[model samples]
Target: MTDENQRVDASHTPLATPGPPGAAPAAPGRARRLAAPVLTLAVAASALGYVAAVDPYEPGHYPVCPLFRLTGILCPGCGGLRSAHAFAHGDLITALGANALAVIGYFVFAGFMIVWLIRAYRGGPTPRLALAPLYWWGIGAVALIFAVVRNLPFGSALAP
Candidate 1:
């Protein structure tokens, strides 16, 4: 063919060429990102539904912590479910009685989740928390303190 005839016409806009036929589709990271928020909402809804339907503190519905039974030692996570159940039922005092630290954690998590959902829906940047090593150490120390104090007579109020 002559060069003149072979050349694409500048006046005519080139249409987008379709991708390769039968080629494995490219991985969809964006779809995965979008799915995350839906999954999170589903999980939160399920949790709320469960909390509404069942009482964690009720006898025969839940089991006691083996650690609390064996050594009479309260772990950092002990009574967390009871705390959540109480909080879900709007019994703040009982929630605090069940696990003060866990109640605080629940609030922090709720705040974080709300922010995450808002950002996700708005197509905003994900929030980042860059905690220093000292901050991490401080968290561990606080948990240790909670564990120790809740077991002692002086910190009896913290105990479940």
Candidate 2:
């Protein structure tokens, strides 16, 4: 028979290859992945513990930002620590007061992390993000608005 047309006989069965003589048994689900969410929670808890022990609010602990100290301009990361501290303490209002934008960012990060963890543990296909041109432009616009609003006299409350 031609190689293309050849087929195995129905009575014949394929033989299994022998493993190395002294190899230890492999664990079941060895290929199964570990969940990322658990690791994230552990790391976050550790960070919170450190933050609590070394309170940044205490004077002379962390260095002051040159930009904010010199120019009085609030950078994107300003108030991030205070916001995180408030968040860790379970005071949402205080966190928002410290940095509204950071709080919004925190929520978005949390939501995405939760979704990513769920899909990973369920053996679902990894999530892929494809932002349309409009979406990207919208994000830029929002950031611009946040910058302007935070600096404005009326929106000073939003400032860090």
Candidate 3:
């Protein structure tokens, strides 16, 4: 066949493979779109419920922080469980006292989930943090400062 005939045949062919005969391409259902956000909220609620039920203040209820155990230093995550427990029980003051950073984290996560759920329900694209590298470094710096200050005598109020 001449190049012109071959070109004509190729041009006539569909670019994408067709679906089953007489079948229309299906769009994602509302349930499918909302699945991720709903599942995430459910898991978080379950976890907080467990924390609320259990007493983390009691010894043996939860494992000791390895960093605190070994180095006598409180890491950023120290007292997070206790904070979560307090937060779950509706004691904001106690939650902040347990771990202020964790309380802040809880608020941040709650905000993110709220936005995600709203967007998912509206059939919008999934939300992304999209923080720049500098912002990430700044966050790390804040955590490090929090860790250091909480361990200091002057920052006793900040300590767990």
- Tens-place lDDT digits, model 3, residues 112-152: 99999888888888999999999999999999999999999
Per-candidate Cα lDDT values, in order, are 0.80, 0.74, 0.91
Model 2 bad stretches (over 4 Å): 1-32, 35-37
**Candidate with best lDDT:** 3
Rank list by lDDT: 3, 1, 2
lDDT per residue as tens, model 1, 1-160: 5788677776884445446755565554555655776687689768866865787767777677888889989988888888878887888999999899998987887887788767776667766777999998999999999999998999988887
Q: Which one is best on TM-score? A: 3
lDDT of 2 by residue, 12-84 (tens): 7435435664566443341344445567767877887776577678888778877889988876667778888
TM-score per candidate, in order? Answer: 0.72, 0.69, 0.85
Better of 1 and 3 by lDDT: 3
Any idea what lDDT model 3 has? 0.91
How many backbone clashes does every candidate have?
0, 0, 0
Worst 10 residues of 2 by lDDT: 26-35
**Better-scoring candidate (TM-score), 2 or 3:** 3
